[model samples]
Target chain A: MVDVPQLVEQARQGRPRAVARLISLVEGAAPELREVMATLAPLTGGAYVVGLTGSPGVGKSTTTSALVTAYRKVGKRVGVLAVDPSSPFSGGALLGDRVRMSEHASDPGVYIRSMATRGHLGGLAWAAPQAIRVLDAAGCDVILVETVGVGQSEVEIASQADTSVVLLAPGMGDGIQAAKAGILEIGDVYVVNKADRDGADATARELNHMLGLGESRAPGDWRPPIVKTVAARGEGIDEVVEALEKHRAWMEERGVLARRRLARAAREVETIAVTALRSRIGDLSGDRHLDALAERIVAGDTDPYRAADELVEGLTNGA
Target chain B: MVDVPQLVEQARQGRPRAVARLISLVEGAAPELREVMATLAPLTGGAYVVGLTGSPGVGKSTTTSALVTAYRKVGKRVGVLAVDPSSPFSGGALLGDRVRMSEHASDPGVYIRSMATRGHLGGLAWAAPQAIRVLDAAGCDVILVETVGVGQSEVEIASQADTSVVLLAPGMGDGIQAAKAGILEIGDVYVVNKADRDGADATARELNHMLGLGESRAPGDWRPPIVKTVAARGEGIDEVVEALEKHRAWMEERGVLARRRLARAAREVETIAVTALRSRIGDLSGDRHLDALAERIVAGDTDPYRAADELVEGLTNGA
Candidate 1:
């Protein structure tokens, strides 16, 4: 049996393996997850979470590695959680991404882990926050949560952060694509990565134009700033970091950071509650109550809404 | 106010505008949806739902159009629900896809509607089945559900169909990509579209090899068959239709069709139930009960699971 208290102590001392184990428990929905979270809760609320998200091939991993280097140079312990919600089969693509971030793999002050949702019920919604908590309790000064692709789940994950960084690359159809993916609204700091490539200036210009088109901010409102960087060559990364810090400061001054964290906590709680309820509903199917309702619906004797009402009634009545 | 009975009557008589209006109501989650669904419950179960899905640039739209023509040739009334889950902006790309399908716009026997989730809470899960119900009640003998992109939502939407058709194109990196996207396990019919292109045979061979590597089927189990086609020119569509029919026959023979329908109905009911519960949970946040819990969690006084447990307990006790 795993020693939960011992594991928590090891993680708090910055033992990477214990942190990984806690995250794995969260990913697997292991029975001991509740205890782990309870033990870690008091130690969390310390790490500053910055979520980086963009389309594939947009240099997210490289930028993440660069950010790790930048943060470590300042003597801050950093944690990286690379989340892949797209792939169901875990570890393959995650391993490749970890390899790309291998320079930091051997650094004792840096903790890096790759997580795949593996077709979990809530995908990253249920897993990422807990993993972030683990990192936060592991004495990390900063945690970078990076997602692989631009999808609804990825956007949702990015929005959970205190500061969300949306990345784009030149000639990638990213300006309008970002809007369509709903990332434009969620970005606190936007990065035009691969800034040395052709049309870099145009991409940044178009992005600025697009971002300005729907502006309704007051004079003192926090406007999201765009940073240009060549993440591969580690060029302009410090500027990107500065933009992030400025955004963080703005959020802190406005009390937006506390509000965002509270909202994130609310969402995490709601997701867990819903997932628990769903598992109970799944149990109803095993007992043929749901099956009976389904048969009635399929036979046209009833509709799904009425059937759903019955299920909810049973659930709320402690069935 | 709309007349639900009259509208359902018009749809039963196959009036295209009535069908469109009913679908609009479903998409909008109109308050009268329960009444409409109750009225249409007995009228459904006639359409054979075939879901076509693949990555972008895999000729999904072309293959879907060709399949419509093939089914129409046999005098089958068809309904097409082109779902774009990836695009939150909606309408622009959906309109483009509709123009691609304009050749059937004037045909009274054909009903084509493009639906976008618009970032709805349950997304396509909540909308697609209800839309499918509308099309089925409108007297479509065959209904086609085509989703844009290869993502988790698209896979889910495809799986809701009676027979899921997974499309692929040569040189699309689709052989292994299929397995990674979790589409291989959900496909009831496989189509390699753009067959005239280079590496078509290699794609097919590689897909076959991958499909065979995980074989654990019994003697009478239905093996998913791969059909090659150049959908733009309408080549090999008849064979695709034949494969679909054979699979449908196999399912009916084993009573799998009825069972699949029952399972689908069960899922629909469960989603509706969960969505209703989620809305109630949302209400809790508005009243600050959830906010209090969230504050406690953020303050490290409690973990999310414990907070969620309290929330669920209140909900079950008629909170």
Candidate 2:
């Protein structure tokens, strides 16, 4: 309804309200959000997208809040998309993360948005990335995307970001297994949050040991830096920020940035493709042809792949 | 390649080897697994599908192993599908779950197979239920679907099972958040897996308090029983088994089982529809027309929904 392009331009000029309005529009309104995103896509890739993810009570939000506040201290505008997983039935936060993070509400230099993983099968998918784009286009220097917790979805959040931080806590035994299952591969920097807690050192040592066992993909020996932080108290916050910068430098020095950029483009293309495919599929509603195929497949009359192939050929060949 | 129908008949006749082979075939060969499932669908609803999921290192495998051994002691032939998150690179277990579970390998009364979460985005999907079906058709009195550590993917496992048991450890801080995420709602039974730990009682109390906050969905005070167990030592194993049986009865008596069947059927149908649609779009893989539309959508000249409509209409009208 609003002059979105004009508002986008205003946001590009660093208007905080315009930025906030743009993010809200992009997140809550899907169709309109896509329209705004189309206008803003070219303006993206400017902000360094940093993803921070960990288990619940691992102080991810607290760490991210500290990071936002820290970046602001250095005169860098920051945008935080704190992804929250809500009770799907009740539509309420188990922990009101957004409300707890309301301390930054008055700081114009800092923009924080709490995103409830709405309607999507997983938290922080379509809407979350689009929201980041809005912030990125709005002239934010750093865009922090925080996930609800560590899991497969958390790894996804890492994939979308320019730099991925896997947060770990003390006392979770066999943390190595958690790391080995795709988490270790995704992290550019590992933060042992709540460092004041006992066993944090041991967790860090275990992570370093595990990191040693794995082969590094990046050239020039890019070991993911492990930083210790008590995010709630803002202790060791500067080191975490420095580690992020150092990781970026390492990537740049090794020419991994170019590779990362190419990967990002491919990912961007794939994300749009998958989204378009899903949306197109939704339009089929309940086609009798599809239902029959399902029955045949379920009845052992046909294989799923073969049935899939038939459906594809039939549709594509102008059935 | 073995005679699936014959094997199904043997499983129905309560042959454990035949049941084990049936599950193995499903696990190793998914395409053939579907063929086998189609043959076995009408034969389902015979075995109770029980899912065990929680955070890693919380003794889920041990608990499952104990449960399977207990059920066997009671003369019940049990089938165990331990779903391990397969390494995306190595295509093997991140942890040696199967090795830990290999105790039942030589036992005639038990069938234990570790399944890798192949190509599944998170915790477990399609494969979990498909494997369960093989066991059910093979006429196992109890089918235990064991999932590695809790996260978003873990939630999917709950929906797949008739009775879901959520395992929790004593030291995992803020156990309440796990409960608050509606895990409490899905769990038919709750197990404190490592009761020897210091905080086990606290975790149990937290679970009970969380459960108490939710309104009872079942009739006549059907509160999910919370059983404490040191699964490694097999302590409280009988209580866990009793809890599962009691929960299953509650489901049947309250007509929840029938409703669950309908829900699962609907879910399976939806999955088939989506997979079919994905394949159809996939067929247009090299076509310039779809790619051009994607570019337009990405360029903001067309909205995703309208693009979807165009795609559907194009397919229907022979573009």
Candidate 3:
């Protein structure tokens, strides 16, 4: 017996070790995950998920640390999940983020976890929403999911957040890349950190310019406001929080917040379903069936499309 | 009839216009892809696939174009598939590569095509294999798949090629990053492009040291030899080509070449099958089924894991 109910209760009581153990179950994709999720499901959905993303070296960790401090000042329990999807050297990079935020470690109200691929289930992003549910159930008033802004991974991260904050630094060429990578579209609030540096105002101007050319949201669509900060010194964080709160209010008023939560739940179910199907695809029967089709296709007896049809058919039939 | 057979014939006759149209079909992911893949299956396995990859701005395009020229000098027809897996900014960046290689555009013996997304389906890498098959059937002696080695996309690129070349530039701090990203493992040949740069040798030395610690292949396994090159000036290309040739021969000798092709084909088939399953997940009767599950999960009537099971089951049960 894994004692999911007891652990969930302990987690609700803000026991750090219990929270860590529960998240570890999510990371490990242990068999008991179903029970844990079932146990924690009713208690979730209260915490606000704010996603912070930026190109590496853009001071995302520092900005996130600053945000945590500001939220703590409001007396809100905050949970931080720092996800590093780019590097397999995740341990070192994730450690750096943790060390930067370690000043808050003594406070039990702040629960910080750094996630890398403990095991590759497509990506660590896939496990994130589940871990988020744990934190949400554990009484965190806010949960921040921070990830390196890269290709497809960033899109997944944005999907998980209720309010997405796109961070940048002066002279990183991130403004133009942001427009190109479609980061501008996903962001609800933008921050140009390292505001003390030269070119900071220019970076803000450029991001604002790019946002101007972005897709026009519906008539009442929220405009993303860009704020500059020297996150190194925790300057401008209150404004960042203010913008986040404004966006949260806007999203909720527009029902976009509810839709986003629904979409997140939908994606979570889809990920699990797809993962199950994928795992089922590797059984001895399925492997042989797939290899047989592949052999025929390679031997020119059939094409990939038809073989795929047969394979999908096999999934429901004979084994 | 769309004259797919005639187009295939024209392409095989080495008509650049015809080859370009066929590759366009690949980029568009036209339904005729099945017919084309069946037609090209046997003709593939003739051309050698050399994957050239590195961090962007490391001159991967220059190296690839230089190799195209060297192969053409030997009177061998070559094909280049420039896969821009980065952002939408890929259009301009990839164009630069094509323009540089356009010097040979009139030769008729070289085929260069760039594949950027017409849409988002996570099928960017999937299209490359089919395109490679088209090039093989079109009588190219060598088909180079060039991609920006940023993250998981690079790994996918490596898996598609028979000989994977890892390119680096001095001062990119890429040597260590490469090790962290697991780039050091997939490479069959390594090149330090822009060897004339101040820190080139030091980069080479560091790469060699990392490679030294890398796992040894079988006793007779081919060691991925590191070669330095000034691709912009077309220097050291002959050695790069030689190393590629040597690796190809070694792979063939060890039967690794056959296994790799088999794996590639298997992956292609699996990608199609999985894509089919994924597509079946969110539409028609399936949409309602999933929404119902999602609603229940959101309401805590059931957990995501259980809802996922019901959804997967519903996928096979209904239309």
Q: Which structure among the candidates has the greatest lDDT?
A: 1
Across residues B154-194, which tens digit of lDDT does each residue of candidate 1 receive? 67889989999988999978867677567877888889999
lDDT minimum window of 10 residues, candidate 1 chain A:
A84-93
Candidate with better TM-score, 2 vs 3: 3
Candidate 1 global CA lDDT score: 0.86
Clashes per candidate, residues 3 or more apart or on different chains = 0, 2, 0
Off by over 4 Å in 1: A1-3, A85-100, A213-217, B85-100, B176-178, B213-218
Worst 10 residues of 2 chain A by lDDT: A85-94
Alpha carbon lDDT of residue A302, candidate 3? 71
Instruction: At residue B42, give the lDDT of candidate 1.
Output: 95
Model 2: share of native contacts present? 0.10
Q: RMSD in angstroms, candidate 1?
A: 2.9
Give per-residue CA lDDT, model 2, range B1-319, as digits (tens). 5787888898888777787677767555555666676678667767788887775557777788788889888898888776745311112543455565566767776776666664642124555666677777776789887765445555777656888888888987636556544465677788988899999998998888877835656557577788999997999999998888887887788888766765564455445445555444545545755566556644445544455556555554644
Distance from true location, Cα of B188 in model 3, Å: 0.9
Instruction: Indicate the TM-score of model 2.
Output: 0.79
Model 2: lDDT of residue B150: 47
What is each candidate's DockQ, to 2 decimals? Answer: 0.74, 0.19, 0.56
True contacts kept of each: 0.83, 0.10, 0.52
**lDDT, candidates in the order shown:** 0.86, 0.69, 0.79
Docking class of 1: medium
